[model samples]
Target chain A: MSDTARDRILERLRNAPRQEAPRPDAPASTAADPDRGARVGRLKSLLEAMRTEVHVLPAAEWIPRLREVLQARAIKTLLYAPETGLGAALAEARQQDAAGLPELVAYSETVESFKERIFAVDAAVTTAAGAVADTGALILRPTRAEPRLMSLVPPVHIAVLAAEAIHPSLSEAMQDGRWSADMPTNLLLISGPSKTADIELTLAFGVHGPKELIVFILDD
Target chain B: MANEPFENNVDRALADAQLRKNFAFAMGNFILKRRAVFSDAEQTERLRTIGHAIKQRALSRLPELLEQLEAACTRNGIRVHWAETTAVGNRIVLEIIESHAAARVVKGKSMVSEEMHLNAFLANHGIEAIETDLGEFIIQLNGETPSHIIVPAIHKNKAQIAQIFHEKVAGAPYTEEVAELNAIARNTLRRKFYEAGIGLSGVNFAVAETGTLCLVENEGNGRMCTTVPPVHIAVMGLEKVVERLEDLPPLLRLLTGSATGQLVTTYVNLITSPRREGEKDGPQEVHLVILDNGRSRIYQDPQLRQTLQCVRCGTCLNHCPVYTRIGGHAYGFVYPGPIGKILTPQVEGLEKAGTLAFASSLCGACEEVCPVKIPIPALLRRLRDESYSSAPESSVPGRGCKQNWAERLAWKGWAFLNTHPRLNRLTTALLGLVGDYLPPAGPLERWMRYRSEPKFAPRSLHRRIREEGIADE
Candidate 1:
């Protein structure tokens, strides 16, 4: 009585009159557009429309540039995963710029113990696994080293995306292996800051996730 | 609330002027937003066709896909359960929570849970289910059902929300500022996210091949609910499954483009399972509850199966003039607008929800803007047909059981009169004797008088002209 529902449902579906639609063409992960450069430009404008501040810079200048950005914003503390490449660069920068421009906190402890402190942090930076140019979305494939909360809990989120990893469409990103069989437990695509229009249809940002989403696109 | 009939609900909703205005304004914005993103008409048509095909295929292959999804999810360490009815679905959810000994649960927006009244069930069983979505949270506090699918509290303006906050929310001051009100909810729910022991969410699309649950949301609460808790449970209708992971792209494109006019929602979480060995923060245990309720019955009829193609985009609601005029709660069920006009009777028993069939204007606006092209007006007509259909209940037969006497007689009279042109003209001429355009006597007559052309002009102009020999000029 408690569990026969599954069998009953399956049985019903099994007996449903068969109507099959032709399978869709295999997904193409890369943008079908002839002008790849224009897609990136279009992506930038779209992201900007969503109120996300976008920066397109070369790989060599990413760390120095991020340092300039952090100092410019006057963010008191920055949280990052030490295992990531960007995390290592930040660690080196923090040691060199040790005049308390921005305190760098390494997320080495378990989240359960440091949950409160994690919330109090001003900003967190993570490296995006891939991005969709059409939607201007950055994909965060959460791993143990760079946990899911880093991009989610903080008020400000700064993500670094490889220019080459940007796909023409979401379908292309998935078909091209950004989201595969052996993918992480959770894969997140962030289009902009957390927002809601529930209060009288007036749009307001930063309800639960980051208030500001700053993406650094590195053209290597 | 669920048991109230549609007629009663519609009357009450129509009497509320503020609710009508909110629906008109919000639905108008939604229309413009959805249209803006699909500027390329040809591409939009291509996607609509693809979306329709994908849904058709999924519904046709539902049994196989459900099995594959269950098997794949189990392999990925996610537990799977099923419920044939809303009550069973609630009981199953309670049983899962009972096992966890969880007290407080945080939930993202799940219309299926609303369908099951799972929050009420959980409360009855001594567990609290908190809706983290701001719109849902407001409706929950107000002790009202959601008025709109996308904007649940669309019926309330800032002043009303501010008043609710002042009265209900702890330490909240009376402020009609939208930003401040959002902040109050954010601060209040932020604490709940960390304290809640379990989280529940709805699935946007469940992939069969990889056994993933895809969710689209603009706010981060979905992320909080799925990730922050130790235990996570997801509930979805059986029709929400898709065959392949790649099939998601086109469906998602259509869904988001039609929903809020975004290229994509702010957040699209693809969850495969609970936390693995190395994951630092995520649910330790995950569960997926697949519900049947009455969806299987809908699938039995191939024509009606198209109703299941809805991606819950709410575009049809935005485009539906009738829905915009009267607003959501008037439909008197979990879903509202054109889709609800058809779906309510199908799921809740056509006999129980039969009046919903009459709620539509039979306008094709919903069908026209439907990303998946569900023949909504036709389906509504089918339900209307079922309501008045004289077929007796048979276990082997279809959805509705009741027969409407007046409707049957009216159709009979229409058939008889239309077949005999002499009688039809005689009756028309006799009615025309009531002074060409007499004042409408009643609601039915008022509508009839306006819709019908004035009795055939005394004599045809062609005959008069030919007789007078002025036709050549």
Candidate 2:
């Protein structure tokens, strides 16, 4: 940074209107409450209104339910993460099934390799840390291991979000301590399937992103 | 590339029944969704006030704000470059790519890059530029310009896309199913993401306090474009600067609500600098090119300066009745609709684009939805006046002759009418007769013929009052 540029930025900051100072002593572990559940329920309703299919399951049963849904939807290959619970479930299900229902692929590998695996598959399923109840959105933090292309390249995107992740607003999500440090540098908040109404304002689905989005809400 | 005139583009769009239907359905739905989202006029008014005030504050202290952003970004290890002209901006980007000896560049949707024709410039030097935005990618493959601000391929349908994909994505079979088509593109672009050495993106807003470049998108391509590649370059118009991070919330609310009727887009990635130490994935080096182009010139004109505040939400295009009928390409520029009418002339030069200023019906819809409250209609009128005055008088063959003829005729008519009221009445009666006989010839005659003549009020009001014994005061 040049001294001139640095000085310019400092000057602008000095001129800006001051805001109420942020409270620095807030607790990191804010208690989870029953209100979180109600928010999730309302979010589920919004998803329903948009014609998206939603399912809630216990953490233990989540993997089986996801496998069933993916199989039923004819999903063949998927992008996943071990840190997210859904990744563990899919792994367990794949091991138990002698007949490979769908291949579980990780995004950290070579792009050419991932493409080859995804090209044969029907859809991609990833895990979401949370969902914004107000907007029926899922938040996914993609890191080096979880390549960003997984979410966009697939036709149908299945996001597995824990019920505990539901937040009333994006501000609350940002305030969460988990996001402040080692924040997976890239966070994606998906609302619905990728769509465009650009051609003569005509609504067209599957333009740039996933055409269909399915969210699995886990209770455990 | 088609070399068709802008009028022909409008004609082509107007003739397409399916496209018209599609635009009607989409824009109608968007308008209704916006109304629902902003149902509380009072709340909207409050938001508008905050939005306008914040932008004004930022603009008022632009130099300082830009400096603060540059400092913060530098501390975070992001390289920031400033260019006073479009040529300089393009050159900076080209030099950056050249330093890396990069050949293939993949880009996220950046209107500024399009305005500068960065892709063509890079291609001229044997560098291949690919658009990662689906709509932009489709248009690029077709060798055409973006027709819509948000949806670049808005004029193309699925069948057309399927055909384009078949021809472009080597060995891919043609399929009309939306999913199958999407899969093909996904497969094709997956390799591009990894192979491309440089990723180019557009900055939606640059925070001066944090030196953060904010990118909002639905697809994850923006993240890929900014992160997956080793080198990331962001090109932004100089006016995109904001004073602080706190001002973002309201502007984001307004932009998402107005642009897509979403509470927020799927992704609002704020990159403070290049990937920090211990970070898993992001560009190794991040460069920001601030392009002034013709913006500084626009800032010189007080009334037109407000146009710099545009966030490019594209609500103006979405709500424009004329744009809905003719799509975006008709404007013959990257921007379209009411905002385009005012901006194109100023940015591209009025000498070449003066006619676009007169395209608006001046319905004031653009001003109503503008988050920053740019009075677009008034600016357009001002441009029109400027264009008219600046036009070479000698070029107009009969300019003085026409004015002299009109002046002579008006004085003669005024003298004749003032000297003989009866003759004037006779002439008026003759006009009425002639108007009736004309059979209502287009707009001019129709306007007069449709109105009732008032029957000369049966009798003068003065005469009636006198007969009734009322005193005329």
Candidate 3:
């Protein structure tokens, strides 16, 4: 990234509206809904039906569980976060895995560094604030740590979503447009694996985005 | 250039029994499936109404809608550019690549890009633009324009494609097996996806409310082209806008069902902006280039404005008997069909492509199947009228002129006979006398070719009625 481009991005970020914290007194509408349990159950069943494995955990336990999954799979996993502790946890994981274990990578807020990390890793795991129950979509506010290509180019994708973040419909998701202002230049609503039927209407998987998607649900 | 006339291409295609068989089979299945899907007349009418209303709403408030869309997209970090012409559209895309200092650009199937000939333009500027859509990729490798709008290489056979792949890709063995050939293309294009610095796509619709660009494709290449590359640029015509996200479903249903007889395309990507935080896999930088390209000029003409409502389902071509016989190449435009017959002349100018208007049989099949209900036959007639008026008198064949002369004389003689009963009787008797004197088949046969000779009545109406005493009564 050129200095000018970096400066421009910084300036844009500085001028961007600060994200409003969730109302503390507000009811846990998403989590408390009677349908939330059913939705998650259905999502798990659907994923299982598609031959994908699902994992459930608390948010506090996600980082460790993901590291374990990546190690078991023997594939390089890159974690993207702007928070300092998240980076520290990833680094600690790498140090623990020094004896020829799976590589654990972490990206920060710098676009160039983020780009470098994305190209190096085979799978990407990121956190989404919400997931749409209707279409099995995960919504994330991507930043430098989660470069657009990271989610796409990798063969496998794991998106961790907080239980309270799930939305019932896209319309409800759109109602929270303020959260979208900080959105990257592109917002993709990916339902399932990347697939194509271009050649003689034959379905082929993994043309662009991850062919396999694993959603990790976490109770906040 | 191939040094082959359009007719020669048609002849070659006609001779290819396999290609004809494949095309006929596909077209027949598509027609049957689409008919079944849209069996309910009332539902189809409602869908058409909704689609037309949405398109009309977008067109009426285009400037306002575009600004709203731009604002929403920009807030989400997507860059929006406007192009006034094809050259500008191509230039804007090339500039996006140059800014990234990209050496290679991988593109998904985009008809607008093809219309702009952006690949060649980019190649001239020393940037490689590889098409990623299988049909488009095959045609691109062959260095030919798309024969059909939906199926670019519809005129080609499997063997022909295998030969092209073998000749183009070094060390690649020829294979008639579909799966092996697909694997070869996949392996070749997979590298391009990873290496290309930029991706280019075409927009199916741009939602003004959310500033989202929707792309519907059966192939995952569209997803790859838009997501794998760091930077993504989408070029769309100005007419491809709809007012709200709610309007998408109906249009999508109609487009999918009418185009390929699918319940829905395998993939429907709705990109609001670029990549956001904590997201994996999407373009970091997204640029949208909206093109006008004489659309506003067409908008000014009420007779032709309905063409803007076309969703490009290609049903018109499939049902067009003439198009099925001659195929798409003879029309000589990016769009080839009944819609092309009207649109090409308007966009490229009537003087340049006037004869295409005369290609139709005016059977009204295209108008019947058109999803948006564009009055194609009426438009064709208007184009023909324009062609005739503007065409030079010397350009018309002498045989046509002779037929016109005979028709005019026959009408004049009928008018003269109507004014005088005695003259009518005399003319009737003269016709009988001439018929008796003429040889069975000689010069009269040549005259018959120019004008049909009416069979002589046995007796005049007045004489027969008088003999029957009906006149006295």
Candidate 4:
């Protein structure tokens, strides 16, 4: 049934008279900024405007900052992917934590195995593929280790972005990463925490996804 | 109410002062926000032009692009389904759900699904289809469709929404506070996301190059719906396909900036496939349902094809005076406002939706604010013509269904009188003598309802010209 429907639809589309609109001229190109600091500044302001808490720190201090923020927010259970480099570092940090750090829960198994536990998790930590300064968006290419829901599902999402990886815009980030050529199974450009202005156009945060998004910009 | 006369719906909507106030307040904010983001007129126009071109380019190669999109998605292990009608689309979705023995569906914001009336279809089949988008969830609870595209429940104020939540939701307290309402919904639907057998979403942009289904949403519900469930099914109008991944940025920029004046939506998800091996999360199976749903017929006409270029931004509705006054419900369809005026008639047939074309004041505000430059006013004018045209060449479905002999004869007589110089002159002279004394009655009654009857000149222009020794030519 679907095959016949498909064939008929395609045939109808093919048989339809072609509508010729004026061919669009190439888009006006904004000059890519050569300065990295400008990109970082733009990303910070944009993210801050959208109510994302952004902390730029030396690589050596991100762990301490993450620990402090988690403690401040009273987060108890932290979810982390077990295989990624950042996850390994977080595991190492948890091993050496004196006190006040949240309980580190490694997502070592399939989500079905720990769905309830993960939903009850206070926070989740993951590494960003890159960042777009124009929109203050974190580009996440979820992989086997850093699964899609690590940055979602939890009440809070703490993503680690390298300062050197921030690009001028989404187009620049896509081009720099050559994403189109070898795209990941899932790629997301998340600008802020889950938000909605649906009810009477009033803004509300953390409707379904993580209410709080904390981005640690590693300056190392 | 979908079959109600357009004028009747408008009258009912106008009578509701609260609905009018809600629309005015909401549209005012939207208009201001859009203006602030696109402050630079030149830059905004350039972006609109690029966005327009990309849509046009993609549409020009639509058939090939759809094929490429199918192949690309298939290569990525994403199943692609085609449906010529909404019924077929609904059946395809049902089959997918029943295959997995899943009866619960958590749906993200999808206008196409609404057009399919998928929720009702699923309900009839004894399946639970829950709306996850905050706005959509509210309206679904009230047994109503979306009043606005971006903001589905824009017609309801906070008080009304609080009442709906308090009444419909079990153990939910009445709260007019936005944050509390959001939290209530979050706690309510969050579990549904994890428990649902299937997650359904509308595709914003279906990229052909990388075979990606892009979804833009502010709330995490969309991400949750596409990620948490084991099976993810996305439905899109066939025209949603873009030729390349690079075409996304400008279009995304225009869409967000124009839709709600956001620099970017909170989440822009690009799903190329379902969960990969060893992945701990994300949907295991991904299905993309491509629905034509009268779009192919609309594409047959060169001029009318512009309708497909819409990106579902409600800026046109925000700028439309008629829409602001009447709200979206007055249009009585899944889509409402200026875009709906043209789209519904064409899709549902002129016989059913022809009155929508005449609902517009033709102020051209819709076209001016349109991100893709879809000449909405011009399209509305064309639909109006198609409604009256008994011509065989008319492509719109149910064309000439509205052609009444009395109206046609009146127009024809007027045209005849104007075409002949002597007849026109005599009519004008006769009108000069009695036009001032003519009562505000008959066809002119509606026109004079809002204003006093106009006083005619003592002499006709041609006669005055001759008396003043001016050339009559």
- Which docking class does model 3 fall in? incorrect
Candidate 2 residue-wise lDDT, A1-220, digit = tens: 3454334334433444443222122212223543867887877887766546788878777666776777687776676765455566667777887353577766555554454555445677777768777656777776554555566667787877889889876656766634433344455667777654433444455555666778888886
Report the Cα lDDT for residue B111, model 2: 92
**B171-237 in candidate 3: lDDT tens per residue?**
7899876667666777788788877899999999888777888898755678778877789999987
The DockQ score of candidate 3 comes to 0.14
Span of 10 residues, lowest total lDDT, candidate 3 chain B? B393-402
The DockQ for candidate 4, computed on C-alphas, is: 0.79
Q: What TM-scores does chain A show, candidate by candidate in order? A: 0.89, 0.75, 0.66, 0.93
Q: Write the per-residue lDDT of candidate 1 for residues B166-234, one digit (tens) a residue.
A: 999989999999889999999999999988889999999999989999999998999999988889999
Q: For residues A75-107, what per-residue lDDT tens digits would candidate 3 score against the true structure?
A: 755544544344466567657665433555555
Lowest lDDT sum, 10 consecutive residues, model 1 chain B, at: B391-400
What TM-score is obtained for chain B in each of the predicted models?
Answer: 0.90, 0.84, 0.82, 0.97
> What's model 2's overall lDDT?
0.72
Candidate number with greatest DockQ: 4
Candidate models: Cα lDDT each: 0.85, 0.72, 0.69, 0.90
For TM-score, candidate 1 versus 3, the one ahead is 1
TM-score, every prediction: 0.92, 0.76, 0.71, 0.97
lDDT tens digits, residue span B235-283, model 2: 9987899876657767887888888787767567777767655444567
Off by over 4 Å in 4: A1-3, A20-26, A32-34, B450-454, B469-473
Give the backbone clash total of model 2: 10
Ranking by lDDT: 4, 1, 2, 3
lDDT of 4 at A97: 74
Question: Which has the higher lDDT value, candidate number 3 or candidate number 4?
Answer: 4
